[model samples]
Target chain A: MRGHFNYLRPDCVTECLDMLDQYGNETAILAGGTDVMISLRTGVKKPRIILDISRLPETRQVEPYGETVRVGSTLTYSELIDHPVIRQEFPALCAAMGCVGSLQIRNVGTLGGNIANSSPAADSIPPMMLRDAEIIIQKKGSSRIQKLEKLIVGAYSNTLEPNELITGIILTKIKKGYRESYQRIGRRKSLSIARINAAILGRLNDSGVIEDARISVGSVAPSPMRMTNVESHLKGRKPELKTILEASRMIAQEIIDLVGVRHSTEYKQPAIAGLALKCLEDVFLDSSVN
Target chain B: MNLEIDFCLNGSEIRLSIKPWETALDVLRNQSGLTGVKEGCGIGECGACTIIIDGKAVNSCLILAAQLDGRKVETVEGLEVDGKMHFIQQAFLDKGAVQCGFCTPGMLMSAKALLDKVENPSTDKIVEAMTGNLCRCAGYVQILEAVREATCMKAPLNKDDVTNS
Candidate 1:
């Protein structure tokens, strides 16, 4: 708030693209300013040109497009939670959004900003990974779609070019009978970052056989990594207490191997296992109960 | 350097020249002459400067005045009518939701925005909406009651009587 900068408001996406194309990284895209302002205050990040692109109407919509649902980058988490299509189709995202800073943070924290900021514990990432979110990056006359996971390279790091702005997040509608659940171990219920978070999306055959599975986790390693080994173990396995426990251990071990055991691992490894087990329980084991 | 922005303030359309360094809280308290929007933490962590922009409740301290251009902004000072306080304000008074009253404005605005869209909100929704607006005294019980009371009164009136009938 104390820093001096030039403010730019572009009415159209094209204009924003032009501004970014022209000014490059000197201009920071201002969405809700929830994260950016905090970063500026702490001297963690600095931008001389603060471009306010939140007014672009086209990037503020939530709609179902063909087989993909397109969400405007500037759309706030609160709006996304209340969005009917998002709530019904991708409730995992809603659950993830619900974990973000309280209701007030949800109102101001933009989905685009969340992805662009690329924080390790970004509440929206794990669920977005469950949805296999595609980030739409655009410039004046160029556009490309990149997987959200790939765009995110490391903690507080992303592949986004300073000159390109994120336009939308496109998620393919999956028809496989997948059950989804999210669990996060945070300090408190509100405004707490996840010490470790897990999201599971999979479907069981009518015969109670695991047909396909996808597991994503956050706040464990550098960025939220997909537990593909765990997924592979469950893809053709039968749904049972033993298999679920094994899969949970597999995820916990995989996390350990990747990031190694940190001081928190004593609690986090078991916590991660428990969380993974709970997700599997909710989706595969406890279907009839709910 | 100054940038001109047009945004609705307290339900009225207004335009002002804003320095890029100024936050919406700065504008609301200084240029706009509405001090109801208080600034507590100056960071997004606290919601003392909460306001309803368009339809969502946001921390005004985190919002740059430049970002509010051409948007509808509602503040706590705007919660009163020609003579009577808004239903949420009245409910807070009746329910004793205010402790020090510093956090009351943000709480009321957050509650108003939530109840405006959802006439009948559950206890969880009330808690969810008010989570960003921190009350040091932890007056959440009374604040929750105030929002519920407003919802209870506003539910029967239907949409016709919502805006000060």
Candidate 2:
């Protein structure tokens, strides 16, 4: 709380990019300030210049191009949850965002901030990864786009340059036949970090056989990762109770292969299986049952 | 760095010179003489510093004072009109929802935000909205009843009337 920093609010993306270029390593870009404020207060990070991009008009929009949607970096969880397009087209993403911090946190925590922070336990990343999300990064005079999986290089780290800003996120639209579900287990329901979370999207053919599947899990590895091995195992298979149970076990095995045995693995191993089963059931079986 | 910020607090517009690091909770309690905005947790975990900023309930502790520039804020001090307490405040008193009184302001703010959006929120909705504000005194049962009671009262002429006084 006894730190000295200069705050700058830019009206447009151009102005913000200019400031980022000028300040470079000395500046910190703030979206919602939920994470940045905590880092600043705990002495985890110290930046002389605080560039406030929460109010920039350029990063506050949600637009659709062809079959993909581009979400502004400053869009808060509340805004995204209430968006009709997101709620209709991406129920799994909406559900994942809804599980973010409490209502107060959702009102102020931005999707961009969540991505930029790159916490291995971030609830939003797994859902976005399932949808094949990409982020648009901009520096002073140029810009580039990177896949979400590639952008986040490690825990609490990303490929973003010191002078670069994440302007927005682009998500591929879910196909009409696809059904998706997000499941998370935390210490408690609200206001707690996820111990493990899963996002599953699958398509079932008319004959009741799984045609395609995408799975992503978080908080079990160095970063939130796509479970391609599990996805491949489930694809071209019928989504029966036995298949789901096997897939659940595969999810546990995948996490073990990624992070090996640890203090919490004994608990997390079964918990991951249970969560994966729940997510797959919700997307493929529960709706038909109920 | 010091900067001048103009914001509306408790239905009145005011300008002040504040540091970039000063939180809105600090400015409201120390500079603006509004001590009702308590700081149970300096971090955003606790909602003790909840305030209405542009019709949304937010933790003032997480917001920078400079971010309030050109914005409107409403703290617990704004919950009275013509020396009479708002209906939400009265319900809290009648329902015995104020224990130790530290979490009252924040609880009231969160309730007001909920009632403003949903005139007759279900019990589940009420619980969901109040999840952020915590009371270690274990007064949640009565707090839940108070919010439910406030919903049955006559709707305010203007939603801001409960907080813009």
CA lDDT of every candidate: 0.86, 0.90
- Runs in model 2 deviating more than 4 A are A287-290, B155-165
Docking class of 2: medium
- Could you tally the backbone clashes for each prediction? 0, 0
Badly placed stretches (over 4 Å) of model 1 are A288-290, B156-165
Top-DockQ structure, candidate number: 1
Q: iRMSD (Å) of candidate 1?
A: 1.1
* lDDT (10s digit) by residue, model 2, range A1-290: 54779999999999998898999799878898989988888888789988989998888888988999999999999999999888988899899998987888888899999999999999999999988899999999899999999999999999999999999999988897788999999988888899899999988888888888899999988799998888888888888899999999999987887788888888989999999999999888864453
**DockQ for the candidate 1 complex?**
0.76
Candidate 2 C-alpha lDDT tens digits along B1-165: 579999999899999999888889999999999999999997877799999888888888889898999998899999999999999999999999999999999999999988878878999989988888999999999999999989987365555677888
lDDT for residue A282 in candidate 2, whole number 0-100 = 84
